[model samples]
Target chain A: MNNELLAVRSVSKAFGGVQANQEISLTIPSGKIIGLIGPNGSGKTTLFNSIVGYHPVDQGSVRFQGKEITKMLVPQIARLGLLRTFQQTRIFSGLSCIGNMQISAPVVRSGLKSLFTKFPIDDMEDIEDILAFVGLHSKRHLLAGQLSFGQQKLLEFAMALIAEPKLLLLDEPTAGINPTLINGLIDRLRVANQELGITLFIIEHNMRVIMNIADHIYCLAHGQLLAEGPPDKIQNNQTVIDAYLGAN
Target chain B: MRAWHYLIILLLAVSAPFILPDYRTQLAFLWLMVILALSWDIMGGQMGYNSFGNIIFFGIGMYVCAVFQRDSGLEYFQGLLLGMGLGGLAAVIIALIIGNALLGMRGHYFAIGTLGLSVVAGELAGGWDYIGAGSGLTPPLYPGEISERNVFFYFLFFVWAGITFVSLWWVYRGRFGLAINAIRDNEDKAEAMGIYTTRYKVSAWTLSALFLGVIGGGVGNLIGFIDPKDVAFSGATFGVWMILMAILGGKGSLWGPVIGAIIFHVTQELFWTLFLGWQRVALGLLIVLIVVFFPEGILGWLRQRYPHRMRDANNSTEKNKLNK
Candidate 1:
């Protein structure tokens, strides 16, 4: 019953006879690590997309910090301190790693002045800090495309972190990373939540990552929530086993 | 280079016509190309919108100037301003209509949509007599022809400098530049980060059009006569030339288009004087070779070879060197 940082109430979305998400209700309280787990096509991504305004929900409402943001644009939601990352790591390939981070920082001015003057005060230090946090400070000057797959994943993480969002939605952070990198990413997420007090709603399929990092877990099967509990109970639940683990 | 570097370059440019020979007129044309290329770079290159209809604004400016001069007997400078205003208005309207429809399309489709719009604009101009069907119109000569030429050349040089500097500055320092670059890099990621991709894209189109309009007016006044074929066909060539210059110079680099324009136009003039009809084939070959071998263009190639030399030192000390 702690104040919910993000409230998704009875949200539903559909596309041409296919219901991607239906009647999904979830609340993420401030400073908690919540996991969203599901098989492929279980509407985990669709739901995340809806919350972040990537895809409009056909029904229900999304309220962040007591503001009804259903009609807001994606950037507006992000400015309100809610941010999401793609499942496939997306970084500016042409830009250096630091350049990618710098461009994502918000702009303060419009017109001629904004073009001529470089406001150095805002997020330069934060970019360095995030790069160091993600172990990418050493590679800060490298073109993002030059990074290895694991490093690209880290860069994406760093980019998301630079925004300093109140709510961070990570989509499959460990999808293609090696086991060592997975541990590193999970450790960073822990630090982000515990040390920085950033709320996290992560969509992950890796059971080890979910079990190790998630405070609470929601499991979906074929676009419906099959189980929800703390990691321990969710791991032991028969419905989760039959729907997810049994098939695997 | 720092801001001082730009100031020095502008000063040198302003002083050039005084010392340079009759070739200043040719240099003025080169400056025009640079302005057009830089304007095109804003929307097509930096924003990755891939528009091929850039000539639409230029043509609109030409036609409007023609109409204003012929029908209203407006002064040459006044006609240019009127033309620019009309062109900008047309660009805003067309950009909203076409940009909204085609901005969502990726790659070739987007290019084709812009090309289609250019063609439609060309056809519309060809059918309108107010500007001139296909025959075109001529502006009465302003008195003091020699002094006027020098004045006009210098005027264009300053305008060129102003437009190029402003365009580059806008792309480099502002939120709009950041947003445009984000969209170019990854649209979905940019949106998720709270950048409005559509609005930024359309705005880029509008800004680019404004510059194109101004340049078009300048060119129309410089020539003293305008025709639909000149407006449409030459305008289209201007669009293509802008893209070529942008790609050749370094699409994302602020100084790239300027350098590209100078090199491209100078070479073009050289070829036209020497090879005449074969210049087109040679130019085509050059473009193909550049696109194939040096995808990032000359500045890109230079950056690869001398990475540290191109680094913007004041922006970030931890500048990552781009590998060839």
Candidate 2:
């Protein structure tokens, strides 16, 4: 319990009559990369949403950092140092890359009074560093809408990084990204997990990327947990192979 | 666009009444339009919560101030000042109460919800006899000369508009601006990024209401009458004009609504009498032209045409400051 960073117990969510996630339970221990993979419509995104308080769980509770966050709102859960990126990139398209980073920066340390205070110009170097880290340094001044879709995904990742969250939930970080940038993103994810000591919970359809980075993997099918184990074991597990890896 | 340009505009505004003493009331109304457009942009443009019922606060302020003045029996200026303060407070309180419910709505739903709010306020005020019902309430007459009254009201509006402009400028350079702009860009992601979207939305609306409410009191006193429908809560006119003027200038940028208001008011006032019976037609044509040619507003048009010019202006200012 003390080592666990997040614990979701018997969580269930329904969209009217559709049971997206049913009796799902999972634990992410500190400083580990956890992967959640499933075929399309297997409730992968719904579970991420449930854990981060995007919507209320129909039954069960979520605990982050030893505190129950099931009843909290998105921003409240976010303020506790757990943040998530969208499956479709969610960068502020009208703002410059730096502007997106600046907006995400203040949320980590301040309260309502910060609203009237000046932009934290003090974070300029930090923002530049993170943008450079994500290879978005050259596009920092351009409106995010002008960026290629891959760059927009990187901008969204950089935004989550700027918040310096304790645990980052990434939904398909490489979904629309350029193939060449995928390896670079994987390296950065490892650095964030190992060097910066940020835990990661990623939902990926890209088996190669997840297998390369995730320490442990969970397989979900038909809204229920199918398998959980080390990457290699999960890769060879007959159930996961038949259900998700497609027996090829 | 620069500090000197602003200074020149300030000089012109300050000297306008003195130079064109005949048009003092029209000039006062121009400043009122500026206040309306600027306040509306805080929600409609910056925060992306396009509210149509902001005029409710304005009416509340007008009635609150007038009622306080009537019942308090205080000195004229003292009563007016206290009344305006109470009116502003009343608007903020109302915003706080309804903000949670109404602001929870998104996009067109929020717009429609707010539209219903002003109509209801109009009906409620129209039927309330305590505030004079439909016959209207006449505020105490200005104590000074007829011309002096114009100048006094002109300066009152001028001062308030200036405060609105400066306060928005200061706040927009800060976290509040970034937060609201994030909401404008994408609200769901803004919440995930840890912005309290509802709190910021309510605060932004309340801020707009505070300005509108205070100005509403001054407007009531300026016009010297408060018709529950036409004057105080005229949704079809003042409320719609607030949105139209902001969109005319540009919705998102800081100076868009300001410039938009200047053009809108000048055009409306200049052409209102000239067109006579065709004034509404002329106004309709103007709206059509704005939507067709300048959907992004005048500033948006200019920015698109001379994007680098604005960027250069900003760069040069920074370069000059660094040199100094």
Best by lDDT: 2
Model 2 lDDT per residue over B76-153, tens place: 889898999999999999999999889889999999899888889988988889989878899887888989999989
Clash pairs (backbone) in predicted model 1? A75-B194, A141-B320
> Chain A TM-score of each model, in the order shown?
0.93, 0.96
Give DockQ per model, in order: 0.49, 0.74
Question: Which CAPRI level is candidate 1?
Answer: acceptable
Off by over 4 Å in 2: A106-109, A245-248, B312-324
Residue A166, candidate 1: Cα error in Å is 2.1
- Report the lDDT of model 1 for residue B303: 72
Error of 2 at A124 (Å): 1.4
Off by over 4 Å in 1: A15-18, A106-117, B1-20, B70-104, B146-151, B232-236, B308-324
Q: Candidate 2, residues A39-124: lDDT per residue as tens digits?
A: 89899999999988888889999999899999999998888899999998888887778778888995434877887876545688
Q: Record all residue pairs in model 2 with backbone atoms less than 3 Å apart, i.e. clashing.
A: none
| Docking class for candidate 2 | medium
TM-score of each: 0.88, 0.97
